[model samples]
Target: MTQAQTGLPDVNAVGLGAPFGWLAGGWRDFTKAVGPCLIYGALLVAASLGLTAALYHAGAIRVLFVVAAGFMLVAPILAMGLYQTGRMLERGERPRVGDILFVKSAIRQDLFILGFALFLVYSVWVEMAHLVYGLSTHKFHKTLPEFVHFMLADPEGHNMVMTGTIIGGIIAFLAFSLVVVSAPMLLNTKSNVFVATLTSLRTVATNFLPMLLWGIMIVALTVLGIVTGFVGLIVTFPVIGLASWRAYRDLVPSSEGDVAAAAG
Candidate 1:
């Protein structure tokens, strides 16, 4: 049976399995791959900071709520460019920094799907956070220091935080389940979106443990990026992007035969 029959995508088709030497290679490659993404990320940070500064200067911190709404409205569309850039790098091609400007043709439908999924995930996360806090309200009230301080100090509150975190994590996992393989699959093939999403969900369900570990590593690295004020994202984003392509290569079955059939 061909690799496609075995349900594995081509590892070498994208040149994604380069040895560690070529995978990250040096700071130069990292800079090349990540520079464009960093600039985009920086733009996002600047917009957010500008809004925050304007609100603070005006003594209207409450305006941050509207600013946050604007952020959510725009972030998913920007995320499409980020993922597409990663795909280009995975294929061992140099994407121009301005290539993201052609966002009109790239993954528009998938971005909408991803955004809706994220909304559901965030809603669930918020609900869980509120539930945990509500449960601990009495304890927080009776404790020394204020509610926020008490939550930070108590073991039970810590457990609540852990519970809320896990709940949010599960939602995120579910949201990604519908898209992880589908994103690349859609990029590579002319398959229908529903079929692509179904295939992706099946791929994740069948390959649960490794994908779960991959998800965990992504979260950890993202947190590290945030903690480091996004400077680390300059390296982490491209590395992880390349790594994701490799992971998808390892996970998804080859489609050579299908491609040949379609060409004919």
Candidate 2:
């Protein structure tokens, strides 16, 4: 793979099942480093539970849906530890809980830039969700059951769901294209967020079908994690995180020679 004028290493084309292949690679890493990886996943589950409880107690039951979908926007950053675990494994080094938690490269400014950008996108998603929900219903449901009934029994809720899905999917896919490669690249390479994001965009643009399938699988698995009361996230999150690192490596240059040789 050659580094083009745009600074992106040539992206690889994979089969539609590439995402699953990544997940399988992730699972292998997870098993190899079960203790640290499971600990990391458990931490994510805790955070998920904490957020769901806080939102529920705050009587923002209407927003549970938003939170579930919006989780994708910030999940890349959250998956940093998983990426670290995968990276360490790739180097034939054993990873520990401490290594995953306090990764040295993760503290860089470029990652901060990416994180802030993700935060901005997440904020926009929240506001857009509010607007869509408000337009859909005048009444704010206070409980999960009430919200479920409103969505299932009312036409307004149905329209809102459809509209919100379309809008959210667009925003989420854009966010995914920006982060899917960049987040891991920033950690793995000396690249800045700009280059990282550009490469990420290029990867998706050049391989749209595979990228689309990857995005769908990510969202579907995330929804599955949320629906299972965050319990599923204990495994799903880590698997996705580890798998994401695999995806980044697959689509971009992993070694200095890979980029330099391509540049030549």
Give the poorly placed runs of model 1, Cα more than 4 Å off.
1-31, 47-78, 90-92, 138-148, 254-264
At residue 47, what lDDT does model 2 achieve? Answer: 85
lDDT of 1 by residue, 1-264 (tens): 444574443322222233232234423444665667667666655665676677757754323323332233233334545556655654567767687546444546654675576566666655566677677555434322454465588777787667756765676677667666665555554555676667767777766765666566666765565457545555565555545544555566556643442233
RMSD of each: 6.4, 3.0
- Model 2 C-alpha lDDT per residue in residues 1-264, reported as the tens digit of each score: 466554666677778888889989988988999999888888888988898899998998867778877888999988888888887888788999999998777898999999999889988999999999889988978888999998899999899889988999899999999999998877754577898898899999988999999999988888888889888888888889999999988887556743452233
In model 2, the worst 10-residue window by lDDT is 255-264
TM-score for candidate 2: 0.93
lDDT of each: 0.55, 0.85
TM of each candidate vs. truth: 0.68, 0.93
- lDDT for residue 160 in candidate 1, whole number 0-100: 66
